[model samples]
Target: MGNQQSIKIFLALMLSTAYIFSFSHFGALAYNTLFKNTDAFAAGTAIGHLDISEKTAAEAERLLEEEVEKWKAKTKITFSYKEKKAEADTALYEFYIEETLRTLKQGQKNLAAVDVDQEVLEEMIYRTSISLGTVEIDTKKLAADLLIGATMLDESGYTFHLENYIPEAVRKSETISKATVNAEGSLNEIKALLKKMGTVEIPAKAQFSFLRLVEEKDIQMHHSSALSIMGTAIYQAILPTNFSIIERYISNALPSYAKLGYEAKVDEKKQMDLVFSNLNDSAYSLQLSLKGNKLEAILKGQPFLNKYSIVKKDEQSFTPKTVKQYNARLESGETQVIESGKTGLLVKMVRKIFGESGELMKTEIISEDFYAPVHKVVVHSPVEPVQVTEQAETGAEEGEEEEQETPDSTTDENVPMPVPGAHSESEDGTEVDEEDNEGDEKGTEPQTSDNTGQGTDMPAGEEK
Candidate 1:
């Protein structure tokens, strides 16, 4: 009995010693991981448990540097961070960290830093016996949580100047490509668009321009959809001589809105048309035609608005009075005569009487295929004939004509001012064209010519 008791006591003593040794070893290992070797240096104690790692502090500088590099590459700004330190438990983790970061990147573009003074206190409990090896820690979740609080700055750190982001090239391309002006549009339409842009308050304002150069050799601009072709009218800045080339140039620059189920077409003079319809039905078909000095717009059925018409007499002029007069004539079922200096237009209205509705709508100006002399008569002849003569004489004199200065060329700058919307001011803030300022001495009788004012059924606004 004595021997057995002695044996039991010895065994108990050995077990207690083993437990103490193991606990000491485990505590030392846990201490090392928590205080000296963790990423993000997360050294914080929660409840009675102190979760800490020295590895976090060691990697703090490297993490900051990495973040700085990332921001530099992605944006136009750059940043840097400085190393900061704090003890456990009593230290302020967020304030200290933020302060340290702020000092490191002071006045450095958009970079800001925060100092996190961490306060960690560790408490441990262990059995009195047994030998202990290193304790394996599960750091995956902890590391992720710590990383949430850390940030870095880099090379491309700078103040944001939003205006600079839009390059001059892009602005130029957008301005020309997505012009708001429509061809042969009415003054009302032009005014409406400009008003939408708040031009009434700030007249010179422009909307955001969107332009994209496509890889395809040719690009088609559809107004609504591709299923059918339509009309597109544009009010553009064009010289009389450039009428032919301008058409082709515009066709290439603009995009088709046809994917949305409409096509655009440019009409004679400076009008644009957009047509919308489905393959099976003409019943719900509609045409949107734009015209006038301010590029006003109108809509009509396939062949409904063809007979009665109000057309522009000149390519480079915007006459609001003329447009209003045209509208009035169409309403009264009267034949109106529009005389602009020497340009004479005889507008005949074809009244429509639908059912018992007394006088139905007269006509909608679908496309104005009208061209007339700039002056009713020049001292000797019409404007076109005179231009033809000038060309012929120039062809004959070729080299000699290049050196000769005609009276027309010398006093061209002395012409009277032009009406608004009809002509813009020249560089010297003056209207400088005599052809627009014809007098009684130029011609008395109106020139005779075949008017192309007759409306034709053009395919909806599909640009060819």
Candidate 2:
């Protein structure tokens, strides 16, 4: 009897609990129906952190649109790989608003769509990649995360990294720039060096060294002076392109075989070197060939994106002074040029890079050279050393007085006078007739005839 009574008590308590739960649920539903507008968004309807509680569908749509536009205006995505970077801003934002709103109105929750052209976005990023370089990007995740994580309105702009650079293998390419120098040296030795260097392959971003390429035995056999000619040719070839000069030194006296400002002076024992860096990320070749007396240096690789030109400007010249030495062996007023003077030169060479549309991109000074001058030398005897003294002057005057007392009556060739019956060409190309008897005495009167008729042989002073 006691066990049956305990079971009946438990049943009664269960019935009471069910009745209370039902009453509370019905009460809450009636309250919502009476207080809330049926056409409005249910409680806790939100899009992009904007509260849409108790707001009409049209009002919620306007607010969400404004929020989206605001986020887009403030949103910018930076996708980078190594040093290359690409950016996309408001253009990447084309959210699907109606679909999101319909789901939310049907008591379901969904995120707005941040749809974009994956092909176009990927192209934009990959364009910055170099010829022997590549990058990787995830367009799907990049598009969805903007709205899924609700980070669209985040003030700190998004910066996503694409894959690290994957470099491609390099090979020999066409010649981009070249230079040649005619040097006076042994052709066989230079040919040997060129043969050893052959087609030098320079790795991307490698520092170039002229002496490093040649062997120690070769350096000892052939002099640095001859090697400098080759270095100068290589230097000139590099100036017209976008290569960085690392270390270069000039000779105290400019060599006869090297270019003015482009000479790369090298002495193996002295540790002088011609060093430069290939700052670009592409491999190149230095093709050396002998053409007669010229050493040709050609840079073979892909062409630089921009055009490069070497311009020589800002020239200054210093005149050498004349040095004279007196020579007792030379006669007075005699001169001989023992040395020909040369004028000094101060010149600069610059590299100018231009864009495809003819816009100046950059300018760099390659070299500034100063060649010393050798002064002019001459040997001459002064006139004062061989001048007439007082005694010689008095004797010279007495001799002059004696000559004046005995002046001759010879016709002075210096005096201007007409000759008798001088030969002349006739109008018809025949020689005019001349008289035979010739008397050339200075005091004799000139003979003349009356104008009547006998033409004496010829009139003395008339054109025949």
Candidate 3:
């Protein structure tokens, strides 16, 4: 009985062990199949704001396409310039879907768990998705198309014109400031250009360009020099004669009334321009004219400010010093004046604003202008006067010696001999022939007949 009981116990123990082994093997196979066949995300799989988990590649692509299409439809781009406006559809912009998919695939490869640690796996599951990149616009092509449209609009005269809206009843405001500068010399050419410039009506709050107002064709440029003689000193001033006159006239004309205006120097090569803004609310007309020797620029508009005054203070004066230069072209002991000395000026220009009741409102410094001084130059020749005098004396002595060596009469066969009794003394102490004297007095041919009325070959003073 004891032996049978021990055999049963042994058989039960073996069966229990086999059952446990079979169950463990089946559980491991099922777990591996779940990881391989399920469509759920492995770990750390994301793209932008998209939840791509538990989705096939085809499903994710479809969702992303739909989302991008909606975004493109809603997006609108517009460009504006003044009153002109342009619009462009977002569909014209290029978007890269394949490139985005490739990036997402790369992110997926990084999440593979072949040799990943527990910490790494946790990080991958919690990390944010990668970007799908941005849509790109063909800006060069867009600009070309927009430019064509803008050109068409301009040709159609759709652009705004400022001249049609000028306000009437323009009145002269208080003389903000009056600048009286004598035109250095005769500015006839500049006066002609100013006359051609006519009058320009500037719109309210508009800016003005001086170069544009006056074209190169309007002014005739001539080669001229600025010559000034002060006492015994003479100055040959070199400057851009054509542009200098224009610059000086404009410089004197502008910023007279208001201190807030700007000054610009235009350069064609450098692509720079001169511009000034009219800060007043009413339209202003600028008229330039030449009165006598003065260049006058008048600003006409309704008075924006009640009273304005400009104060100019002398800051410093620079006196030119005399400089001596040696000249090889001049004779010795001779001095030529090249330039007359000029004084430089540093002047502070200030604008004073006053209230209607005669109270000063404010004083502002407009500019600190500096005028460069021209130095006095005296040119002296190095050649000595004694050397020139000696040369003249030597030349005179050589001429006298040559004259003494030459004979008064020629002995050559071709030379004609002097006729006897052909010479006669005139009242003026000059030697003259009788025939020539008679011809001169009567203004006719001399007669050949003598007292005997016989034609003879003897000379005029000889009696036949």
Candidate 4:
């Protein structure tokens, strides 16, 4: 019995020694894993597609950067519209590398239960867990950049669609309005302005200003020469002559649309402007262009209203007055006419909106415009007197001497004296004139006899 008891105690001591040795071994391994080799990852670790196992943290970071670069190189984004296309690289985006590294460290800290084995623990301690940082794209910036590229493409004769904005089919359109004007002067600037307007989409019930449509400031800034040339040409010329190609187009066009109760006009100073409501439920796009001598503003969209007619009333004209001035330089009874005048005008533009059944829906007075008149002028001159000659004085003195020597006529005391150029009946039945008996004479006035009744009187040898 004693021997058996001793054997049991020895066995107990052996078992206790075995347990102590095993516990010490495990404690040492745990300590090594927690402090000695801190630059490793736990089991089951990965970053993106890279399996960064058994690598130091620094080494893992390098590998992650290389992988991210490769991914970015392969990433490509493309935008297409009609025949235009634009591309961008993902490398341009911002990345969060440090944040990803911190995430990886946190993930490693939350690792699952680990079995302590010297060989296994040593292997896991060398493994690295990594999380490649995320890449974020700046959408606004991307869109802005894309727009610049697209504009260049468009200017090069390519059609680029706006991001996320595509045009739909045209459901309805018509010759809702039209304007005509005699085209004169350089149309270059007007055409350029229309081209800049290009194609624009307008929302429903929205108002579009012609000035806004052309982007007046941009043109003034970029194409100042064109604007200045056009403005000067229009301003210096006369009424119809001064009207710009754009002004004439708007003036003529507005009336047609105005007949439909759409507001349109060229102001008194002839600044062109058009204000109109879309009226339709759907959006509309307006395109302006110059075709030959015609300038057109076309609206494209679904129609919501009926067709109508414009009733233009009589055009009343003001008569111009003529002014006359006397000029001494001009000959007597002569007059010079200058400057034919033009009459003013006033027209009442009225529009009658009609339904499909020809029923009048509304009447609108679109405009009451006034045109000024020009006056005419005339100049006249006065007349001068006639002059006398030397031969006439000698003839008058001879006639007076002969008349004093001649005897006085006597038949009956009551008989009247015969006047010069007077006809008297002789003994014959033939008629005779006293002036016809005399030689050719130049005097034109009638001659009178003196109180002695001798002959026709001559005053100071002056010719009649």
TM-score for each model: 0.25, 0.51, 0.34, 0.35
Whole-structure CA lDDT of model 3:
0.40
Cα misplacement distance, residue 174 of candidate 1 (Å):
17
The global C-alpha lDDT for each of the candidates, from Candidate 1 onward, is 0.27, 0.62, 0.40, 0.41
Please name the candidate that would achieve the greatest lDDT relative to the true structure: 2
Residue-wise C-alpha lDDT for candidate 3, range 383-408, written one tens digit per residue:
33433456567878887532233422
lDDT (10s digit) by residue, model 4, range 278-372: 43344655455566754445545544234445555655666755543334566756766644655644454455665534577677554343344
lDDT of 1 by residue, 1-464 (tens): 99999999999999999999999999899987777454333333111111223324334444544544444345332111101111212122132333443344212322234333222211110010011012222223323323233333223224211112223443221111111233332344333333332211101111111111111212233322211121222222111101111111112112333211011334322232221112211112111223343132222212221122223322232121221111211322233333333332222222222311234334322222221223211120111111335766777777553444444421323333333333222323343233454232321212111232222221134211
Candidate 2, poorest ten consecutive residues by summed lDDT: 436-445
User: Runs in model 2 with CA error above 4 Å?
Assistant: 1-117, 122-172, 215-219, 326-338, 379-464
**Tens-digit lDDT string for candidate 2 (218-275):** 5454477677788888888887877777667666555677766777776677666677
Most accurate candidate by TM-score: 2
Can you give the lDDT of residue 68 in candidate 2? 80
Model 3 error, position 58 (Å): 57
